[model samples]
Target: MTRPDRICVGAIAGSFGVQGEVRLKSFCADPEAIADYGPLWTEDGTRSFTVKLTRASVSGGVGARLSGVATKEQADALKGVQLFADRDRLPSLPDDEFYHADLIGLTAQDTGGVTLGTVRAVHNHGAGDMLEILGPGTKSALLVPFTLAVVPTVDLAARRIVVDMPEGLE
Candidate 1:
């Protein structure tokens, strides 16, 4: 069963019409599938909403109506509010792929097996995924490219990652 500790899948982009519809931006692989994961929850899980897609959005998202939002004012209030779904509700990944949640918190080790740091977060800025490693006493986290050449192994069972640091990375 998917835990109630939801993983973010989408967000509200502001109201779409006078009839209480809002612009929804989905982060799912299939953008339209965002409505299938309902009822979506707030980050803290204190609130939830049933998402019903009405049509395509004009502002780069989809038009949708959220439960309890019956007026434009009501829908507009949800702008920027993120939507989350139970983790297990998400599709299973292939063996070579991984969810960002699964990669966080793993210990990072260098080629010589030296303990480097813990994985803090993963970021993707249109280029590729990058791992944020926070080593002890470091003022800033080390950003490592999550490439096959650099990250040769990710042992989820062992909660560790084997990294072959490129020159100047150390």
Candidate 2:
């Protein structure tokens, strides 16, 4: 099967009051900049949405109205829908920075050239991005910190990552 069509940029977290506005949880580094990407598509490519940021709240995320949504009920109905932008429209990263998508399939290896696994996913839990590596023939995935000490080299062109795993971490 073809790979999932979209990378999640945001999520609809229910409606924002009685208006058409919906609570948007953006996964972008700068949450408000999600609107700059223009129309976003669904995972299945069935629906497209244009986001208009209205306000931000303390507990909830930014308030936004989708293009075709007209009421709070409509907004509420779309809760949990993941939004995505075209990969090409995303801004280029600096030398030391890398987009999560670019690292997904790259091979993971130790500094000594021993194979570890392939990157199964990239996740950031408040502190920093962690590489979830799924080793060959192994069902369990290992979460490795994506810091300089652990991941010394990231050769995007070569599609490989040379890691100096933490002491006693195999």
Candidate 3:
């Protein structure tokens, strides 16, 4: 996928200290891998930034200094700026491994080929990842575990996900 289709890997949460380090929140499974991708760009494909991890912070995110940001004010101005990397630079996934971007637009279908919804987001809270699938008529989003029992097949090429929805989920 091109940069436009690239997945969001991290975000600038503003400066950590008064010196120059900026607070960065990584969306990657391996948080430190955010720096491995180098030269992250903005959603508009206009601004690009290079991150240098300075230190680990007590808070969940890391402390980093952007290439062009030398002052605290400069870092503060970039608060809430999301960063994206070229999809090609990212490592290929194993049989079960998946990129969040690949699952975002996939159509969720039941075993009988009934359409459940499209995957709107993927989230994990120390536990396994959850597929946030949005049902066709339902206003509330459904959270399905990203496991073989729940999500049996994830065919990215076909742009669809075969999910074995639990008892009442269907």
Candidate 4:
């Protein structure tokens, strides 16, 4: 379950060194800004941490120390822990851009106005964003490239998206 008040900003990639520093994989547009959104909370909201960035890690992530985590073992145990920040603390995006969270659960439709599916997830595997949609009567999910030509319309207020399905994809 996702909280509307919070947004996931980063994840712990395990201990960076023998010290208390942990390798952090930031999902922010400005990766270094992850530390600015301090007091990040765990998924279940049971735990929270103040981030202090130390340096950049070799794994393309930043090395950071979490509040109350003061040992190699302590940092190691927090591997894969996702960190979320209060939505209010984040900067607002321009009209053309959207947060991944906002895109999830939106209804997807074809250019002809036929119902396709609901967006189950938004993925970016180094290239660009893709929308994962699961429709009725289909056993598999549909992966649509989130480009302006493919997805011409996104009506967040209506909770729907207009997609121009590619010929080979259909």
Q: Quote each prediction's TM-score.
A: 0.88, 0.90, 0.90, 0.96
Task: Residues 42-96, candidate 4: write the lDDT tens digits.
Answer: 9999999999999965498998989999999999999999999999999999888
Against the true structure, candidate 1 reaches a TM-score of: 0.88
Q: What tens-digit string does per-residue lDDT give for candidate 3 at 73-151? A: 9889989988998888778889899888788889999899999889999998989899998988899998988999988
Against the hidden true structure, what lDDT does model 3 obtain?
0.85
As for candidate 1, its clashing pairs are: none
Residue lDDT tens for model 2, 23-96: 88888888888888868887677888988889865245788889999998899899988888887777877888
- How accurate locally, in lDDT, is each candidate? 0.88, 0.85, 0.85, 0.92
RMSD of 2: 2.1
**Winner of 2 and 4 under lDDT:** 4
Poorly placed runs, candidate 3 (over 4 Å)? 1-4
Residue-wise lDDT of candidate 1 within 1-170, one digit each (tens)? 22435677889999987999989998887788999999998877788899889996457889998999999999888899988888777888887778777898899999899989999999988799999999988889999999989999999999999999999987
- Candidate 4 clashing pairs, residues 3+ apart or interchain: none
Q: Pick the candidate with the highest lDDT.
A: 4
- Model 4 residue runs over 4 Å out of place are none
- Sorting all predicted structures by lDDT, with the top scorer first, yields 4, 1, 3, 2
Which residue pairs does candidate 3 place in steric collision? Answer: none
